[model samples]
Target: MNAAYAQSSVTLYGVIDPDIVFVNNAQTGRSGGQLTGKQQYSMLDGTTSAYFGSRFGFRGVEDLGGGMSAIFTLENGFNAANGTLGQGGLLFGRQAFVGLSSASTGRVTLGRQYSSLWDFVSPLAIITQWAGYIGSHPDDLDNIGGTNRENSSVKYTTPVWNGVSADAMYSMGGVSGNFAQNQVWSVGVGYTGGPVRLGVAFVDAFDPNISMFGATATAGGVTTNNLGSLGSATTAQRNPVIAGYASAHRQQIFGAGGSYAIGHATLGVVYTNTRFVGLGGNSGPNPFGYSGSSTITNVEANVGYQVAPAVTLGAAYTFTKDDGPNNQGARYQQVTAGAHYLLSKRTDIYMVAAYQRASGTNSLGQAAVASVAGLTPSARNQQVVDTIGIAHRF
Candidate 1:
């Protein structure tokens, strides 16, 4: 390059993860054929192991003088297996935001960004660390895995104050006449002191189908029409755990979690509650004919040990329960184990396995089926997955 900027700097960063996976008791033939139960073996691009997803991006910072700076990030998520875009094909779907920061104050940003839960509480969740995608809390009902993002939003984060920090976000509903039709808001707080880390967060969305899960490439890109069909708004998700409740008039999530580190080993635990209220005809077909509300509660505990300088082992167990209208209840239990070996500073090899069992009535008002996030739903009440992968960053 010929140009030079003295007070500005930009850096390029990316991660690529590819894995071979095995799934059992999965349903197949969704493209117009007899859907049958079968075992599947395939290669996945990213988001299964090592990292959340395969992505590349440019992040830059410009000194504005007096300990202030202008900052921005543009990230793109892509499938390493097929070389296609992830996150609904948006060029910078993973994250795209610009903001100003101050050393004494905080920072404010606008554009597509993460929710406070994603920023604060998610880090303490096992699914975000080593539990893998399949280890998500029964379809990631509370979004602790950050399966969704907020669009057309403004976010504020506070500078750490005596081992504590906080953030908040608000997303515009964008409806001309209905100011709260699809609006979303969230808040979170975190604390870090010595070997202890703690976090808590809460999020509420009006018409979550449109304001949250609907913000995808195939889902019409974050609309304000609460009257739209839920199926159309949540086409990106196949997990039935919460899909049936997408048409709910409101959705709320609360999560609190923390981790404690002792030498080379760490122990973590998290609890989350998610609610879908006012389920009725505001959207499309109510498959289960749900008329009232539904609630899901989850708890997870995990431990990780650094066996060696370059080797780590982790395991987690999660329990989830759902209570819906008409006294329907579903329950799920899962266990996950994984190990990662660092080949180099920027590359690693990993193996992970997870198994889950389900019972009772699911949100669809049918027999509960095991459905791990990022994989096909099981034909029965039990499912298993194993993955071997390699991840690299640059």
Candidate 2:
């Protein structure tokens, strides 16, 4: 087999990240906004990117005459510590696509893929990009870190032209006779000139509630007073804040980010607005207990420095606000810091920490708990986490 593959070049690559983590005020339940009063210590598994979720993929490229090429990639994400699948247990959870490329034009791929907005703008997110997912805005609610992946999707990415590039993507909902149901569409544009780069992206997703809740329902006469009679299944969510709005008919996000490099330091800022529409209707609880439309706005800024040849440091802060019906809303303030030490080109060690505070009520009128992206909700209104991990690329 080794000799048989001599003429072909295929590479396998991935990153494995694991961390020892400590959390203060971790939520004990899956949903319902209940919190624990004690601090918790544990490990960050393959489900999260404490340093980075472990992943490996195979990729191949073949020249196809003048300025063209054939390419394919099959990637999977997993928990580095437990050796389990990530991204909801899909086999090729991270990515799987095949396409042709042209130097003069662009590339097109069809498969499950990230939205254009996420692909183009995620790297500019100072918190998620450098400080880790624990630094992400509340719940990673806007997906500014590209947490949501689209299935049955097609994407096109244009070649850079005068430091500018563009991307577009559409995902099929796969619901017969309902083309837009659970569908996702996005577009992004970026400009990179010297040390300064900027990106703007927009994303629209239909039937967000159905996608998040894993079912479709018609709210017949669910109201506030009898909400407790619906039982626990509908309110079973990973995050209470997001669960509250799981009844939303649709979701939309607008994101913009920019970064500048000066000397050994890079400074960046990212902003996003996310809206959940058509909630608070007469919808019976299907999964989440409450139904209410809401909007989340986030702003973040960060800076990174190469303090030494093998060492780097970064810090970021994010502010988030939620506006919803019945005046049930919340605000979050988060701060994070991290340091990375390079041991080799494909290996590095890092330590990161984050702290967040929350205020006001969540979707179910429960005290808003501080929860970082990719992590569990807090039992109280504030939370802290710290991790140390190593990552390897191969």
The residue-by-residue lDDT of candidate 2 on 57-172, one tens digit each, is 99988877777888889999887778888776768877898888898989998887778776667788854556667766777788775566777888999999999999998888
lDDT string for model 1 (165-280, tens) is: 99999999999999998899999999999999999999998888778887332432222331122334422225567767756888899999999999999999999999888887
Candidate 2 to truth, TM:
0.88
lDDT for residue 325 in candidate 2, whole number 0-100: 57
lDDT of each: 0.81, 0.73
Candidate 1 accuracy as TM-score:
0.92
Model 1 ranges with Cα > 4 A deviation: 1-6, 29-35, 215-237, 281-284
How big is the positional error of residue 135 in model 2, measured in Å on the Cα after superposition?
1.7
Candidate 1 residue pairs that clash: none
Worst 10 residues of 2 by lDDT: 217-226
